[model samples]
Target: MPPAKKETRPSSRAGRLRAPAFVKNHRGVKNWKEAGAWLEWRGIEDIECITPDQAGIARGKMMPSKKFTSNTSLALPSAVFMTTISGGYPEDGNGFSYPEDDGDLKLMPDLGTLSEVPWETDPTAQVICDLVHQDGRSVEFTPRNVLKRVLAAYSERGWRPVVAPEIEFYLVRKNPDPDYPLTPPVGRSGRPIGGGAGYSIAGVNEFDELIDDIYHFSEAQGLEIDTLIHEEGAGQLEINLRHGDPVELADQVFMFKRTIREAALKHETYATFMAKPMQGQPGSAMHIHQSVIDTRTGRNLFTNEDGSESAAFLHFIGGMQKHVPNALVMFAPYVNSYRRLTQAASAPVNTKWGYDNRTTAFRVPRSDPAARRVENRIPSSDANPYLALAASLACGLVGIDKKVKPDQPIGTTANEDEIDLPRGLLEAVDLFENDKDLRAVIGDPFVTTYAAIKRAEFETFMEVISPWEREYLLLNV
Candidate 1:
């Protein structure tokens, strides 16, 4: 998971509770003007203005509440979006370019996301920032703007995309050193996590205190976690969020990761969203359940009035089969991300669509016509929520636009089929750069920057000599 960049001292023990932000006859703050009043009502002493950078890391300014409410000019470097996961800039090459002076981008608050930083020592408010040029144009390179661009594509066609993300993660003992391996945290039994405890009610009880804190933190943030389950891995857990508008859902996932990590810290265990945190355990995935709806009718576009599958549904599947490989880099964004995509890793290796098959990349669950949708199981828990959703929806929309038809649904395990997706970071990056259909939907410049950053990250990873190299190859060679 992305670590929080800015730190605020606890409002009360790292925000175990929320302030009385509610007012008489209260609803939510619908606009910036209303947000100002809500912040004041909450008696916010500090403000943490933030935006998701390319790696989904929180990036932005922190200031006094008065300055924030006064409409202060909050600006960040445009190049902030050009950073790699490691926080270093890539060398200029391979069609990638950066600004000469790193010009400032104005921060426009997405008032709907403004909320209290419950854990801060002083009453603090946090708001997600949207970037814009000083000249009044949206900063297309930013991750949030990238998702907005894709959502606008659906809006133009009078369609809205809905997504529910099932984010899988792990709880492990603290390993401060990077070279050491991770182990499951000792539970209430005082033993390392036992394996094969999938969906065991008793398994969750092992971390009851921690789980309760997670629920508390999420509740304070108004993040509705639909269900929590002990997953197949030793220390793995999954949280499913209720479905809604793609952008809104993405914001919740972005914030939920932070909440999980904080709760873990408070419990003295570490929560990691790394695609494959431990070597032997199943890799983490963020499976997105998605459907398209007619904005005017408020009906699912995947099904007909007669409750049969629609042509748009097949086209969406066909689009994913044809286009998902090119977009895989967004789903598996890091060097570690590919480790989870391998065969037998409890992950999909191909873009085959299947009817409720766990092995296929796209699984169409058996549901009523109204709930008909496809689940994109390719994204790792580590992917930028905005980019992952944007890429997934963009592929489906392109399929709908081109009238593409899908191959026959697979009945058996499709992971046994060819490994259709890119198997490594650099390979996926190359595919992403060459995909014009995806580039046309996701801004071309943004795609270019993304691919270059991935290349730089891969190069950095290659520089490291893993212990395995010395264990096996060094002496043998």
Candidate 2:
């Protein structure tokens, strides 16, 4: 029998006390333009905010064939979406249009595709849309479409990929006081909740209400949450999702993040997937487990006669090892991401694999032949699930095409040979940029776009003079 459940109550934090103004507004799509204007008045630079009508068009939900009036500004990418919502563009049509607005076009909602955000107050509501052009050409550069294309590749071959993820993150205090350096805050008792609890079930239960709220939020938002467990680090936790198709899995991960943020805010806590939020403490990771099945026969492709990995499984492993180095940027995208891939401590710092060995870059859980699959433990919490999944599958396909055979296992740290991994985001990007085969696999657009984003992030980090530099250099100079 299960243990007796404890009494739980809603958080009484300041966030819950103050009602957010936008919660009850029911004005049709018009509210979006107003929200945009409101943001713009506050000096928000990303002027791309949408009107409800434009949102309808993007979601292809319900576009009235009549034009609506609103002189609202939005960010460039957001504005592109707004154009679709306003019936000034086709939902799936492509060709970039900005700064040129033709007068009076009907907006229509397309129901063919839609994604839901679990953190939204309205759980039943959907964040719907499709790429569109004024000239009726669907934009190919949209990130959502990229994942769709990759998922389609597997679907076409009747191979349905099931994926689940364990997203680990830290909860830090939002310190706005200029007097203090940014750090995790103490509870009312003067003891910090973020300090030292390694995989303690009792520790997680101590915050039972918070976890319950998170589970409720997930269920309301349609996320298939399997369990929430305490992680090895202080103030860190892991939320695992039930395995599903690759596309659904990625969507679940993206939605789960927002849910965490919203729930944290209500509790006066800050949640982050920043990979390494604190120095010395264990960092967060986003380990993904994946398996493929034949759609028609419902057969697990990784299984063998002896209930072991098939040749196809071995080939997939080979592809992952071959491309992991080049694809490191996608798995570890941010500057702080590299800090998480240290040797041992359950983090993989080398390009290697082993059965049930968490120390290696990849792990094949000991399973019956019918349930075989690969568990990639390299990606930190900062990884973009869509990009990560796409790159991983691309590598697997390459291995299959080349019939690449994996070498013997790398074993433990004692027997593991010295292997190198990127020490920083720039080095990872450099590795990615120089890899011709990986570039061909992921396409030029993805590689270029990823490099540009990562490069910009690195530059931002460089401009900031850290506290360590000030403490050491200011006194010496």
Candidate 3:
């Protein structure tokens, strides 16, 4: 099937938000403006306006807008960007344990479900609300809101950033098959597990029935899926979402991940976004493609008028390079994420942009003056969409503002002058800790907390002994 057309917000002259086909498909949203209003009424605030610059500075982190307020105390600021969905218990609270977790208080509401009034008994109602602190301050950790704020900066420049993500994940064999209780390690791979072949599109055809269901469910959930194909692993698949604006596109990415997992469970399968779920198999990756458009004239800012060096394009690449190190934490947040940054297999180990080069950290497809743009190949599928997009934009915008210029494009590989991305989560944490530019862009509080969280996670992993240890050490010792 041909891909759908790109959806844009209604022309400012129209004086109403443009309803995309997917959104309009929702029962009775006759007018787009009303839908935007509906979101406002449900406590959905625009990221740019709602994100507390003061709070962000206080948090000292990038994308602090995703944080939520504390439920127990209401005296604090109620305004926040990211919404939280309470599921029986509030996350990170004293009551989150046994009985306190089953409380009735909800932080924020999902705007998509606004048409259904008084959503008391709706089993599907996630009680998903904005993240706010007890001080009524917005939650800084919310990933969705972070991207929203970053997109706003571009919008103010009369440019719209179109973004698409190729998300790869594993559909692993459920260790203890639920249906066949006695059978151990027996999994219905729709064909057979570890059946020799790799990148077998036809092999995955056997699982099309379930995969198709995933596509349809995504459609129903207002997700824009462009393609789905079997990956190199035994039970791996990739789903790509059609790109749009950074904020909207990032939100779609998040929803897509949620939908894929939820839909997979219905078929009694386990879906994982882990960067490297199995050894000796191709890992999952999230390849991001991006382009920019002028908000006023609807012109693509990345394109050049006379096929000359476009200031915007150069500055954008410069921004990406300048902040690549600091953005590592956002791109490869988890320890496992670093495992995917190999030299070959279309994964980038160094920071550089090349024309139509898959090996480069960034790829600018050689296109006509009309459709020129860049692709960032660093991020993994498990990356928080909000943080990834926000960090990229923050870096790119900084380059533009500073008029930073990049050297001759490095195609496929890095040179002596080129810098490498942080090789591991530990190194990434260290870079993030001392990076003044990134700290200035995002803030201190968030960086400190994020580093702390990641350090804690690393420490926890260190305490665990894996099969690799047993296999190598048990026999020799």
Candidate 4:
């Protein structure tokens, strides 16, 4: 792949945002006017102005193309940021939460993210929106804004973070009942997918039609797919996105999730991003590959003048090691997330860095100095991409700021059973709320709001009695 070129917002077009390379490739568009022309040319009827909530779910209003083009005012209650995964609001008041009066926040469309909703028959377009107060103040609690804040810190230091995310998910049979366990969807052979097939070409071909739709949808939206492969678990697939600007890549991830699920529904199946969707199968993960680059020269900062590992590189890893545990709640957000963190699930159990060792949480993949990068394997598939990237980058940035040094890299034979991460959602949230270093970078309000939201979710989960509890403890205890 060629190096990403620096993009400058069009000077001639007032209020134009800088479109990333992928968005720039669409219809030769580089600004809102050009994007608008493309929309008109395509005969778009409706525009979905949306923003990601804490759980990465799209929330906002949908309006007609005329209203969207005319820039009609759109507002959503700030309480949406405080919404739990179960769609419940937390009133525990663990910390100062948003919407004290349930006031509205303005939704400002990010024109660079405008693209056609390929699944819609009415020729609809969707664009990610950013939240702001009525007085034009930025809403710091929004997930996208959290990532933007972290990126701004790197920008101030003349550094830019590049990331490529590999998303793993399962193609499962439709199971509407919450009581029933999910099963792998029947493939072309009309049999339930059995066992792990890991990288077999035949395995991928079993659902060739769905994969093709993914490619088609991705291409239509200008979302670049770096690679696609069959993962270890039955009916599991992983799609790797091309490395690029962190914010733009996050937007792509946010969009890709919706696209994949819509595509799956078209095939009469379900695409689930739950970390542990099915029992006795390898869980899904969202492993992020990241590197820092000098903004001016566009040179990879992880490498030194003599082609050896640079201090900045080690400091980044040191940052991840020091802060990741406290920030684990962001990487593994749900109650079910911890179930996938066990060593037996092929997920990293410790925050140990290793050179090309998959067993470790942070793997420095062997590459040329320019391509040197770290694969953070800790994040689960269910995490919000915006917060996950922000937390990881914030950790590395704080490490560089403090000149923290990492422990010696572990080798392939190191102990694989080290259990260092938070054991459950409650513990993870506890760590998240109290980490001062993380609060300094990710901001204090976000920590408090996020922690309260997670606590509410944990409380909700505690209300349910699981099958295991009924079967094991009903009579024995």
Q: All candidates' lDDT scores? A: 0.86, 0.62, 0.59, 0.87
Q: lDDT per residue, candidate 2, 10-112, as tens digits?
A: 2456533453443223211234433333222222222111112211111223211111113311112433333321124322212223325532222222221
The residue-by-residue lDDT of candidate 3 on 1-477, one tens digit each, is: 111222344546443434344344431233334444333323332221111221121111111112211112112232221111111111232111222232222243334422221112221212123445545554544554456556666777777778787888877656554333211112445235553435677756756766777777665445677877776666777777887767556656665666677666767777878777666666678888777887776777876667665798899898888787777888887778888776565467777888887777788887777678788888887777767777777777778878878767865345333337787888898887777766666755456655655665676667767777888999998
Q: In candidate 4, list every pair of residues with a backbone clash.
A: none
The TM-scores, one per candidate, come to: 0.94, 0.74, 0.72, 0.93
Error of 2 at 212 (Å): 1.8
RMSD of each: 5.2, 11.6, 10.5, 6.0
Candidate 4: tens digits of C-alpha lDDT, residues 180-278: 999999999889897679988888999999999999998888899999899999899999999998889889999999999999999999999999999
Question: For candidate 2, which ten residues in a row score worst on lDDT?
Answer: 47-56
On TM-score, the leading prediction is: 1
- In model 4, the runs with Cα more than 4 Å from the true position are 1-32
Question: Where does candidate 3 stray beyond 4 Å?
Answer: 1-24, 27-106, 110-128, 133-137, 176-190, 193-200, 307-309, 412-419, 475-477
What TM value does model 4 have? Answer: 0.93
Provide the global lDDT of candidate 1 against the true structure: 0.86
Off by over 4 Å in 2: 1-124, 132-138, 177-182, 185-190, 194-196, 414-419, 475-477
Q: In model 4, where is the ten-residue run with the lowest total lDDT?
A: 1-10
lDDT of candidate model 4 versus the reference: 0.87
